[model samples]
Target chain A: EPEVTQTPSHQVTQMGQEVILRCVPISNHLYFYWYRQILGQKVEFLVSFYNNEISEKSEIFDDQFSVERPDGSNFTLKIRSTKLEDSAMYFCASSEAGTGHGYTFGSGTRLTVV
Target chain B: AQSVTQLDSQVPVFEEAPVELRCNYSSSVSVYLFWYVQYPNQGLQLLLKYLSGSTLVESINGFEAEFNKSQTSFHLRKPSVHISDTAEYFCAVGAAGGYNKLIFGAGTRLAVHP
Candidate 1:
C-alpha cells in the first residue's frame, strides 16, 4: 500500500534557527494535515491544507508556523524561528476523498531544538 | 472543539490474552471516532474507525471498536493479542460536520509479554 513519506526522520536545530519539515503525501490524495506531539503528550493538530491554502489551524499554529505546498507532491511546514517548545514529533497525514475517509500518516519527523 | 481521552497510560498483557483500551470524547455534536497504532519511533497507523451505521467498526486485523453515543465512548478490543501487538495506541475524535479536524488522546502503551 502507498504511504506518506517524510524527510529527515530526525532534526536538530538551534533554538532561534529556522527549520522546515517536508512531507510527500499519497500522490492521489487532495487533503493534507500536520500534527505534533510533545513527548508523552497528546497529538495536537497544527494545520490542514487543501487546494494550496490552509483550511484550518489551531492556536498552537501561531505566527511562527507556516505550511506550503511548494510542489504538486510536497507539503511542508516551516517554523520561522524555533523555540524549545517546538521540539516534538511532527506528523503529516493525507486522506483521499475527504476527512470522512481515514487518514494515512507518515513515519514522522522528530524535531529537537536546543 | 472535540477532544479525546484515553484513560490508561499503559497496559501490559501476556501473549494470547484479551485486551481493551478505553477512550472517551467530549463533543457537543456528533463526531467520528478512530483508533491509531504507533510503533516505537514511527508514525500513526489507522487501526479502525467509527463513522456511522452499526456503531461497531473493525480493522483488517482482529481489533474492533464499539461507538457508544450516550456514553461518548469508543473502546478498542481484541479477542487475543500477539507479541507483535505491543505498541502505543491513540484514540481520536473529529467533528462529523464540515471542516472536520482531528483531536487525539494522550495514548495508551500496550506491552505484550511472553
Candidate 2:
C-alpha cells in the first residue's frame, strides 16, 4: 500500500521561531491537505491544496501559516512565527480526487513549541 | 458546512467483547462519512467509509459501520475486538463537491483490555 510520508516525526522549536513541516503525498493523489490535532482536541483542517493553489482554508490558518507544493511530490506547511499554542500533531493527507475514495494520512509530525 | 459528533469520549471493553462507537453528523448538503483509527504514536488510518450505494460498509479488520441518512449517523461496530484494536477512533464528514474538506470529531478512545 502506498503511504504519505512526513519528515521530522517530532520537532521541538522555540516560540517565535520559524518552522517548516514537510510531506510527500501519494504520487497519484491530486488533492493534499494539512490538519492539526491539539492534545485532547478534534483534528482541525488547516488548508487544502490542488492545481498548485490553495483550494480552501480554515480560520485557524491565518497569516502565520502557508502551504506549498515546492516540488512535484513534496507538499509542505510553513509557520512563519510559531507560538506556544502552535504545539500540536500536524497531519498531511491526500486523496486521489473526490471524497468518495477517502484519504491517506501521514504518521504526523509532533510539533512542540517551547 | 459539515460537522461530526462522536458521542463517546472513551469506551472500555474486555478482549473478545463486542464494541460500538456512535457517530453522528450534520450537513446541509450531501456528504461522505468516514472512520479513521489512530494507534498510539501512529498516524490516522482509514478504517472504512460510506459514499454511496449500500449504506453498510466494512473494513478488513472486522469493523463495520452503517450509514443512516435519516438519522445522520455512522456508528462503528466490531463483534469481537482484540487488544490490538485499542486505539483512538475518529468520525469525519466531507461535503460532496469539488473542494471537499473533512471535518473531524473530537475522537473516541477504544481501550480493549486483556
Candidate 3:
C-alpha cells in the first residue's frame, strides 16, 4: 500500500531559527493537511491545503507558519521563527477525493526547538 | 468545532488478550470518525474509519470500531492483541465537508505484555 513519506525525521534548531518539514503525500491524493502533537497532548490540526491554496487553518497556525505544495508531489510546512514551545511531532496527511474518506498520515517529523 | 475524547489514557493487557479503547466525540451535525495508530517515532496510520453505511468497521489486523451516533462514540477493539500492537491509538472527528479538518483525542497508549 502507498504511504505518505516525510523527510528529516528529526530536526533540532535553536530558538528563533527557521525550519521546513517536507512530505510527499500519496500519488493520487487531493487534499493535504498538517497536524502537530505536543509530548503529552492531543494531535491538533494546523492547516489544510487544496488546489494550490490554503483551504483552512487553525489558531495554532499563526503568522510564523506556512504551507506550500512547492511541486506537484512535494508538500512542505515552514516555520519562520521557531519557539521553544514549537517542539513537537509534526505530521503530514492526505486523503482521496471525498468528504468522508479516511486520511493517510506520514511517519512525522520530530521538531525540537531549543 | 468538533472534539474527540479518549477515556483511557493507557491500557495494559497481555498478549492474545482482548482490548478496547474508548472514544467519544461532540458534534452537532453529522461527522466522519476515524481511528489511527502510531508506533514509536512514527506518524499516525489509518486503522479504520466510519463514514457511512454500517456503523461497524474492521481493519485487516483484527481491529474494529463501531460508530454510535446516539452516544457520540467510536470505540476501537481487538479480540487478540500482539506485542506488535503496542502503540498509541488516536480517535478523531471531522465535519463532512470539503476541508475535512480533524480533531484528535489525546491518545491511548496500548502496552501489550508478553
Candidate 4:
C-alpha cells in the first residue's frame, strides 16, 4: 500500500527556536494535512494544503505555523518560533480525492519543544 | 462545523472478550465517520470509515462499526479482541464537501489483557 512518509522521527528543539517538520505525501494525493497531539490530548487539526496553497486551518494554526509544498514530493510544516506547548506527535496525512476514502497517515514526527 | 467525541478514555478487557468503543459526532450537514487506531509509539492508521451506505462498515481486522443518523453515533465493535488489539482509538468526523478537513475526538485506549 502507498504510504505517507515523515522524516526526523523525533526532534528536540529549544523553546523560541525555529523547527521544521517534513513530510512526503503520496505521489498522487491531492489533499494534504497536518495534525498534532499533545500528551494525553486529542489530535487537533493544524492545517490543510491543496493546490499548492492552504485550504483550511484550525485555530491552533497561528502565525507561527506555516506549511509548504516546496516540491512535488515534500510537504513541510515550519514553526517560526517553537514554544514548550508545541511539543507533540505531529502527523502528516494525504488523501486521493475527498475524505470519503479516509486518509493515509505517516508514522509521525515526535516534536519536543523544551 | 464538525466535531467528534469518544465517550470512554480507557477500557480494559480480557483476551477473547468482546469490546465496544463508543463514538459520537456532531455536524450541521451530512458527514463521514472514521475510526483510526494508533499502536504504541506509532502513527494513526485508518481502521474503517462510514460514508453513505448500509450504515455498517467493517475493517479487515474483524472490527465493525454502525452509523446511526438519529443517534449521530458510529460506535466500533469487535466480537473478540486480542492483546495485539490494545491501542488508542480515535474517532473522526469530516463534512461531506469535496475536500474538507477532519475533526478528531479524544482517543479511547483499549487494553486487551491476556
**Against the native chain B, what TM-score does each candidate's chain B reach?**
0.96, 0.98, 0.98, 0.98
lDDT of 1 by residue, B1-114 (tens): 777899999999999999999999999888888899999888899898888899889899899999998898999999999999999999999888555678999999999999
Kindly list the per-residue Cα lDDT of model 1 for residues A1-114, writing each as its tens digit. 999999889999999999999999999998899999999898999999999899999999999999999989999999999999999999999988765677899999999999
Better of 1 and 4 by lDDT: 4
Best by DockQ: 4
lDDT per residue as tens, model 2, B1-114:
899999999999999999999999999999989999999999999999998899999999999999999999999999999999999999999997565889999999999999
Q: Candidate 2: how close is chain B to the reference, as a TM-score?
A: 0.98
Cα-based lDDT at residue B68, candidate 4: 96
Instruction: List candidate 3 stretches off by more than 4 Å.
Output: none
Position B16, candidate 4: lDDT: 100
**Which stretch of 10 consecutive residues in model 1 chain A shows the poorest summed lDDT?**
A94-103
The regions of model 2 sitting more than 4 angstroms off are none
All models: lDDT? 0.92, 0.96, 0.92, 0.94
Please compute DockQ, using alpha carbons, for every candidate against the native two-chain complex. 0.73, 0.80, 0.76, 0.86
Evaluated on CA atoms against the true complex, candidate 2 attains a DockQ of 0.80
Better of 2 and 4 by lDDT: 2
lDDT of 4 by residue, A32-77 (tens): 9999999999999999999999999999999999999988899999
**Residue B67 in model 1: lDDT:** 92
**Would you estimate the TM-scores of all the predictions?**
0.97, 0.98, 0.96, 0.98
How far off is model 3, as Cα RMSD?
1.2
